[model samples]
Target chain A: MGRVVVEVMPKPEILDPQGKAVVGALPRLGFTQFVGVRQGKRFELEVEGDVTPEILAAARQAAETMLSNPIIEDVVNVFEAEVSA
Target chain B: MGRVVVEVMPKPEILDPQGKAVVGALPRLGFTQFVGVRQGKRFELEVEGDVTPEILAAARQAAETMLSNPIIEDVVNVFEAEVSA
Candidate 1:
């Protein structure tokens, strides 16, 4: 099956509490190299056939409309993903 | 500054309610080309300098131990990301 990958991230100006929690937890876990952390969402949409341009456009529209809140998040990426199986 | 991208996804055998909900909602929204959906996580780790091998290793470690729950989730990808700014 063909798959499409869509990535969504909080806007740069938005405050991400989950990411802040992760940043706070990292130092305690002895991984202090990271200066910041931002948590986001990844989606995989499965298709029965090849990922056509129409499917990609539909996925992008779904990403912007259903998957993410445009005011708080940005659709950072939308692309066809190689399916291993 | 440099960034490292980490992706985590639920195990295939695991049930993903959010993904299922998306799949169910897709057809109602008039985009019915998709067969399935899986929701996961994306994390961006910021570093003060370049993403070195050591940082990559640390990110991998963090991904496995902290970012994802080994019981139901898998760390899918960990790589350096080019920073535009």
Candidate 2:
């Protein structure tokens, strides 16, 4: 098997309300040095077969088509590895 | 400066509706092998000062207090590294 990791985030120019909210709350939580915070999503998957270029391509396509919002978000990164037996 | 990486995810027992929606959309996007997909958050921060244990601790605390929802989510991982000058 193989494992896939995908990270999704809002486009840098877009305002991240979720991130802003977290940043705003940091001071109350005793985090005085924290100046900013941005929130995004990570996805990990265990695929049921050998890792191949075709599989990776399909996975990337899947991410773009269904897993992420192309207009408001960006696909930050995608990584894959073999699952240990 | 330092860099902080935080990954947040739903508790394993909690049903991830966003993940489910992604899984449902995969098939339509021509990804037949994808049986499941879970989504979470990743935060990468460039701190403005040297890397220290105290900074790392504060960052973790901030993640717990404001960056994550403790009830329905779990802090999957937190990592820190010194930034190259």
Candidate 3:
């Protein structure tokens, strides 16, 4: 199976409460080396055949339309993943 | 500033309902070249300094202990990302 990985994140201008909570808790966990944190979603998709530009384009569309809310989120990256059985 | 991206995914043995729902809806949306899909979480952390192995290790621990439930989820990969301002 071919694969593609799409990342959906809150747009840079948006506030991420979950991310802030995690960042706040990090210091309590004795981790103070971090300056900030943002959490997002990843979709690892198994395509029907070899991953090509066409497949990636379709995947990007799927991500934009199905996986993310374009108003509040951004599709950060699309990666051709190594698919193994 | 340095950065580390940690991806957390449900274990292979686990079931992913959200991914299934998206995959199920794909064909209805007129795109059906996919076999399966798995959804996961991505953490983008901005560290105080450059991302080194030590920083990666700390991030891994943060992911394993704080970000993910190791019993049901797995931390897949850790990448060093370019921190642009």
Candidate 4:
């Protein structure tokens, strides 16, 4: 088995209201150093196959095409790991 | 400087409409996976300070409290690295 992890986020130029809210809330949480916060999403998938480079590439393409919004968001990172038997 | 990367995802029990849609779209992209897709986010912050354990902890706490929705989502992973000068 293989595990794929993806992180998706709004493009830097786009306004992120959720990010803004979180940034506003930070002072209440005792973290006042950050000038801003940008919110995003993370996905972890378990592929029922060997962890091969091909599988990783396919999954990443799937992520880019279907899982993320190219107009407003981007896939920032992709990580894959072998599932130990 | 330091870099912080966070992955945020919805709780397993919660319904994920976006994930479902992506899962449905994958076959068209030639990925006939076993089943399902869950979407999430990633954040990379360039912290302006010394790269210390304390800074990392503070950033993590900030993520957990303000950035992530504890009621519906969880912070799955946190990674910190020193920014190369």
Candidate 5:
């Protein structure tokens, strides 16, 4: 089978409280080397057969419409992968 | 300067109710072609300067310990990126 990965992330200008929380907590845990942290979501779609180029397009479309709010979010990537079971 | 992306996904054997819910909702929205759906988290770390190998290791360590529950989740990728902002 094939899989498609859609990574949805907040727009750079948007405020990400969850991400900010992680960034804030990191310093207390002695991970103070980072400048910023942005948290996002990843969706893996498993298709029954081989993934066509068209499937990638459809997956991106679905992700934009269903998985992410385009007004404040964006899809970072939509890529296909080969998988078994 | 540089960025690191950490993808944390649930173990294959784990039951992800959130992912299942999305899968169930898809069919109702006329997206019944998929077999399964898995959801995960993505962490983007923005560093000040160049991303050395040591930076990658530290980011991975931080991600494993604080960003994810390693017992039930797996890090799929920890790769560096080039970014302007």
Candidate 6:
């Protein structure tokens, strides 16, 4: 089966409390190299056959409409999952 | 500034209700081309300078310890966020 990967992230203007919490915790955990953190969502959409252009198009549409909230998030990426991830 | 991207996904053996919910909703949204779905997390860790090897290593460590639940989730990828994503 082929898989499509979609990534969605909070918009720059939006406040991400989860990310803030992570950044706050990281320093205490000794991961001080990181100055900031932003959390997002990743999805793998599996198909029965090859991931055709049509399938990618549909996945992009789904990523935009259903996977992410346009008001607060942006669909940052929509691509074929070539790697095992 | 530079960013490191960390991806975490549920282990194959683990049940992903969130993914099942998405797969179930796809058909209703006219996205029937997809057969299955898996939901995961994406984290962007921002640093003040270039994403050095040390920063990546720290991100990897954080991904394993703080970003994902080792019991049920896997840290699938840890890399520099080369693209705008």
Candidate number with greatest TM-score:
1
Model 3 chain B: weakest 10-residue lDDT segment is: B76-85
Which of the two candidates, 2 or 4, achieves a greater lDDT against the reference?
2
Task: Put down candidate 6 lDDT per residue, A1-85, tens digits, no spaces.
Answer: 8999999999988999999999999999998898889999999999988999999999999999999999999999999987463
- Candidate 1 wrongly placed segments (more than 4 Å): none
Assess chain B of each prediction and give its TM-score.
0.97, 0.87, 0.91, 0.85, 0.93, 0.95
**What Cα-based lDDT does every candidate model obtain?**
0.96, 0.76, 0.89, 0.71, 0.88, 0.93
Better of 5 and 6 by lDDT: 6
* Better candidate number, 2 or 6, judged by lDDT: 6
- Interface root-mean-square deviation, each candidate: 0.4, 1.6, 1.0, 2.3, 0.8, 0.5
Query: Where does model 5 exceed 4 Å of error?
Result: none
lDDT of each residue in B1-85, candidate 1, tens digit only:
9999999999999999999999999999998999999999999999999999999999999999999999999999999998865
Of the candidates shown, which would achieve the greatest lDDT relative to the real structure? 1
Displacement of residue A58 (Cα, Å) in model 3 is 0.3
DockQ of each: 0.92, 0.61, 0.84, 0.53, 0.84, 0.91
Sort every candidate by TM-score, greatest first.
1, 6, 5, 3, 2, 4
Model 3 regions more than 4 Å off = none
Q: Enumerate residue pairs that collide in model 5.
A: none
> How far off is residue A32 in model 1, in Å?
0.4
Q: Model 3: C-alpha RMSD to truth? A: 1.3
For model 1, which pairs clash? none
lDDT of 2 by residue, B1-85 (tens): 5678788888878899988887787777678877667788888655677657887887788678767799999887788843443
Report the first chain's TM-score for all candidates: 0.98, 0.88, 0.92, 0.87, 0.93, 0.96
Could you give candidate 6's per-residue lDDT for residues B8-71 as a string of tens digits? 9999889999999999999998999998899999999999989989898999999999999999
- What lDDT is obtained when candidate 5 is compared to the true structure? 0.88
Residue-level lDDT of model 5, residues B5-85, one tens digit each, is 889999899998879988888877777667789999999998888888999999989988998998999888899975856
**Backbone clash total, candidate 2:** 1
lDDT rank, highest first? 1, 6, 3, 5, 2, 4
DockQ-wise, the better of 4 and 5 is 5
